[model samples]
Target: MFFKRPTKEVERERNQRLLEAVYSTKASWDHARETERAVYEANVNSELHYRSRIQEQKFLYLYKIARKFKVHGKLNDGVIDR
Candidate 1:
């Protein structure tokens, strides 16, 4: 049998369903984007924290070396001046 043309009410319902599907899809996409951004920001923050810790360790190591040099330099200077 040939299919009958859809009635006005049926067409309106179909359109409404399509609009709802589109809105839900858009909402899902927006949520996914927001989650991705959050994850990226977290990764960036973690990397920065790691770099800062490395810098601090390097500074401390250099400071210790400088202190040792200063102590030895003073001793050498005292011997030379005597």
Candidate 2:
């Protein structure tokens, strides 16, 4: 029979260390993912804000152009006697 070297207690200690290392690594990756998601959401919001501003400007410009072409009624005829 082959003789095992590491005692059960030593094996348990080593496995605990490895488990802690893996847990820390996962936590760091989750933090990075959350940060990236926040940045993407902010970028989308800024783009939408810019687009709304541009649309408002275009509407104002069109209103001005339409006002320029307005027609005024002329009252040339005097009151008619029945």
Candidate 3:
């Protein structure tokens, strides 16, 4: 059956298929962008949390060192007084 289909029907079918493809592609792109955005936000939050913990540890360590120095200084002063 080599009879060519009507031009109007052929054009309508082609346009419909194209529209469907466009919609599908757009949906997939949107989903990928959302996933990427979510992953980036998670990574940023993780980094901030890690940095906060490190800073807290550093503060505690420094506080302990300062306390030791203060105690050592008091001992030295007492010995000198004697």
Top-lDDT structure, candidate number:
1
**How do all models score by TM-score?**
0.46, 0.42, 0.43
RMSD in Å for all candidates: 32.4, 34.2, 32.7
How does each model score on lDDT?
A: 0.52, 0.51, 0.51
How many clashes in candidate 1? 0
Worst 10 residues of 1 by lDDT: 69-78
* Ranked by lDDT, top first: 1, 3, 2
Badly placed stretches (over 4 Å) of model 1 are 43-82
- Regions of candidate 2 where Cα sits further than 4 Å from its true position: 1-4, 41-82
Model 1, C-alpha of 50: deviation from truth (Å)? 28
For model 3, the run of ten residues with the poorest summed lDDT: 69-78
Sorting all predicted structures by TM-score, with the top scorer first, yields 1, 3, 2
> Which structure is stronger by TM-score: 2 or 3?
3
Candidate number that wins on TM-score, 1 or 2: 1
